[model samples]
Target: AQSVTQLDSHVSVSEGTPVLLRCNYSSSYSPSLFWYVQHPNKGLQLLLKYTSAATLVKGINGFEAEFKKSETSFHLTKPSAHMSDAAEYFCVVRGTSGGYQKVTFGTGTKLQVIP
Candidate 1:
């Protein structure tokens, strides 16, 4: 079985502060982790992914995440938050051995960016 658990359902940040969103997962086989951001009424965009490759992965919009095997965690981080960064973020896990690569989305973490 494969599953992902986002530690928080919401994360708030200032316009110029750092952002952090935590996630954990468990899979029988190797897993693919991803972070996607969705702006207001906008489709979700891929932010980053970990496919049993590099542990630390950088992504667009100055966002990044690190996959820790020992801890079974993939946490998203950003040095500075912008008003534009305010959105809903989802932690996803890719399913294997299926017709299509099923992507499981987290409940969602709402990022409130205060100016």
Candidate 2:
């Protein structure tokens, strides 16, 4: 089993600047990691995943994240901020626990778009 932490409870960015959202994870084994976003009153949508394939994983809406095993981090980044990007983002870690698979989600980071 593994756990994840979303460093910031809320992050604010202007319309066009770079956006950085931090996340850290703990796992006994190589974990299957994923990032998901939830818009206001909307269901969660899968952003990207690290399935032991690529360190740099890209998602929809110009979002991407890098998996750093050495640091136990999987921080999400965007080149530019967008008004539509305002949402609650979650970092999820999935692994086996007690011989059964389990999933854990980080405390969500709420992205606020400012003018």
Q: Estimate each model's TM-score.
A: 0.92, 0.98
Badly placed stretches (over 4 Å) of model 2 are none
| Model 1 per-residue lDDT at 65 | 97
Q: Which stretch of 10 consecutive residues in model 1 shows the poorest summed lDDT?
A: 95-104
lDDT, candidate 2, 1-115, per-residue tens: 5899999999999999999999999999889999999999999999999977889998899999999999999999999999999999999999999999999999999999997
Error of 1 at 114 (Å): 0.7
lDDT of 1 at 57: 95
Quote the lDDT for 15 in model 1. Answer: 92
- Evaluate all candidate structures by whole-model CA lDDT and list the values in order: 0.89, 0.95
Q: What digit string (tens of lDDT, one per residue) describes model 1 on residues 9-109?
A: 98988899999999998876678999999999999899999976789999999999999988989999999999999999999988765555667778889
